[model samples]
Target: MQQLTVKEINTLVNGEVVGEYTGTITGLERIDKAGVGELTFIGNLKFSKKWDTSEASVAIVYEGIKIDPGAGKAFIKVKNPDLAMAQVLEVYLPDSPHFETDIHPTAVIDESARVGKGCRIGANTYVGKGVILGEGVTLYPNVSVFDHTSIGDHTTVWSGTVIRERSEIGKHCIFHANVSIGADGFGYRPSEQGLTKIPHIGHVVIGNHVEIGANSCVDRGKFSATVLGDGCKIDNLVQIGHNSVLGRFCIMAGNSGLAGSVTLGDGVVIGGSASIKDHTTIHSGATVGAGSGVMNDVGPGKTVVGYPACDSRDMLKQWVALRKLGKS
Candidate 1:
């Protein structure tokens, strides 16, 4: 464990020290769990009462927030307590282990593949024909990159992840375990022979700083590319259908599914388990709440919720009415 004095932590977070107590903080924990020699944060007013009851030796609090003088803990007041705590965490957390810049013997790389200098290819990984991997790219054990795929610098494809043919991944992206990129789309046509599968000839394009979580799937387009814009974050078990385009900085939570051809503008937030119908558009700054089923276009900056999603306020009123009726 690393220990930092009150003055050292205050300088790190640019916070102002309040109170007379002096001690070194050895660890960071939640308000309810922090004990002696630990630092905790009070970010919400609801948790303010817990400050006095907590046994923590030090606390981080937002500017202008009042703390009981009797709490006995030293306080560091900052503009944003949550962000300050994160800065402190970075100082104490251990860095991830680095892998040697060498390809494992069990890995198979096609003769035509171009691997940049300093790349690390792990055991059982396969780099297919004509693939281009940029500098410092790391492919963990059991990872697969199919023909002609291009992955940019500093990207990491974790164990069991697969990047299919012609997929383009940008720099600093992370594809977690079991992620499937450029998979065939769920397209079919009725014919005399039965349901004929529509071949997906296109691929997936992920922009810089995007992160696709474990078990997530991003399908290839029918003719064009399925795109994830810069800084987008996709949570675990997400499904982005064929030709769907997510704009910059969009966030899709766990279990959220976007149907084929869906379009989301910049900064759109899709809550956990939300489902968007095919061809629908969610404009910039819109938010779709958890478990919502979107069927139509959501205007910019709108908030929608509930099954067959509507305005959030309307949904809340409906819930209130239902509860009153039940009471009667």
Candidate 2:
């Protein structure tokens, strides 16, 4: 673990020292779990009472917050203690893995594939014909890049991931283990010959800084490309159907799904296990709460919750009314 002096930490978080104490912070932990040589933060007022009992040598708190004088712990006061804690955690976390610029012996790259300088293709990975990988790209074990696919510079595709044909992935993107990009959309036509699959002739386009979590699936469009805008984050087991477009900085939590042709505006947040119906539009800054089922468009900055997704306040009112009626 890395260690930083209390003074150095104060500098990192742009914080001011409140008491005279010089100690090294070796780790970051919750207030209840933090020990000596660790740094903890009191982001909520409820946690303030535990400060004196905490074993942490250094504590980050909001400016003007009252502290127990007898605590005897070093204090760093910041404008936003929670944000400061996040920044401090980033400084303490381990660096990402690095690989040599050599393709593994078991890896196969088609003659027509174009791989740029400083790339690392790991064991059993396959690069199909006409694939283009930019400089410093890393494809871990068992990754598959289908024909005509293009991956931009410094992208990392982890093990068991598949990038289907004709997909375009932008720079600095991360596709975690078992992620499937450009997969066939779930479309079918009912006919005499049984339900015939609607062949997905399109691809997937992922913008820069996108990070897709493990086991997520982004289906290819029926005619055009399913688009993921810059800085969009997709959590594990999420499903993005064909022709879905996610705007910049949108966040989809674990197990959330967007049906075909859905559109999400910038900074939209979808909570865990939420489901959006096909062709619905969710405007910028909107939020869908956990387990919600959205069947219509959501306006900008609105927060919706519950099964058929209504405004969060409306949902809460309904729940309260039901509880009162039941008691009566």
Candidate 3:
């Protein structure tokens, strides 16, 4: 068991300690569930109010909060308790899966592929012709990299991910299980023979530090690449349609989707299950609320809510007015 003193934990987060605690912390847990020898955190007033009832011997609290570290308890105060907790949790993190060998015997690499040094290819993985994998790349079991795809150094692709032909992945990116990159877009037109599907000849370009969750899909474009900029984070079951362009640090929560040709500027956040209309542009720092159906462009730093989304303030006022009418 790894043990850390209250003082040691405080040093890790650069926090101000409230009590002279000499107890050792053995683990971290939720505030309400924490016990003796365990540490917890409070980021808001709701959690801070639980301190008296919580069993934790130590805690990390937001700075400037009115928290009392009763008799035996200690509090480490920081600017952001959530971030500090994350840094502390790293000490308790377990090891991830790794291959015993650099290249597993069951894995297949095409003769024309260029795999850099220190790459770890897990069992049953396939690297197709002209594939380029930079150093320290890890392709977990059952991963499929198609022809001409390039993955940069230190990128880790989890099991069952499929990178179709011509895809480009950048350094230090993580792709969770079952992710589909460079898939055909849903493009069809009415024709004499009913419906004709448009050919998707382009690919996907993901920038450095991007992290895509499990089962997400990034569709290939009709003529150009579908791009995800550096530090973009996509949640599980999200969908990025063909030719969609996302700028740096964009975040799409679970089940959120962008229709074809959508453009999102830096720091845009799409809430869970929200859908952006085709050809729509969301400027930098805008946020779309959960379950919203966006049909028009959103300005920078604006927040939209409701079904057929409008400005958050306007939507709240509308809700209040509706409630008043119901009572009238």
Model 3: ten consecutive residues of lowest lDDT? 91-100
Worst 10 residues of 2 by lDDT: 64-73
Model 3, residue 39: what's the lDDT?
Answer: 92
Error of 1 at 171 (Å): 1.0
Query: Which pairs clash (backbone N, Cα, C closer than 3 Å) in model 2?
Result: none
lDDT of 1 at 248: 100
**Candidate 1: which stretches are off by over 4 Å?**
20-22, 69-72, 98-101
Residue-wise C-alpha lDDT for candidate 1, range 212-264, written one tens digit per residue: 99999999999999999999999999999999999999999999999999999
Report the lDDT tens digits of candidate 2 across residue range 160-198.
Answer: 999999999999999999999999999999999999999
> Can you write out model 3's per-residue Cα lDDT over 213-324, one digit (the tens) per residue?
9999999998999999999999999999999999999999999999999999999999999999999999999999999999999999999998899999999999999999
lDDT for 167 (candidate 3): 97
Write down the TM-score of every candidate. 0.92, 0.93, 0.97
Using alpha carbons, what is the TM-score of model 1? 0.92
RMSD of 1: 2.0
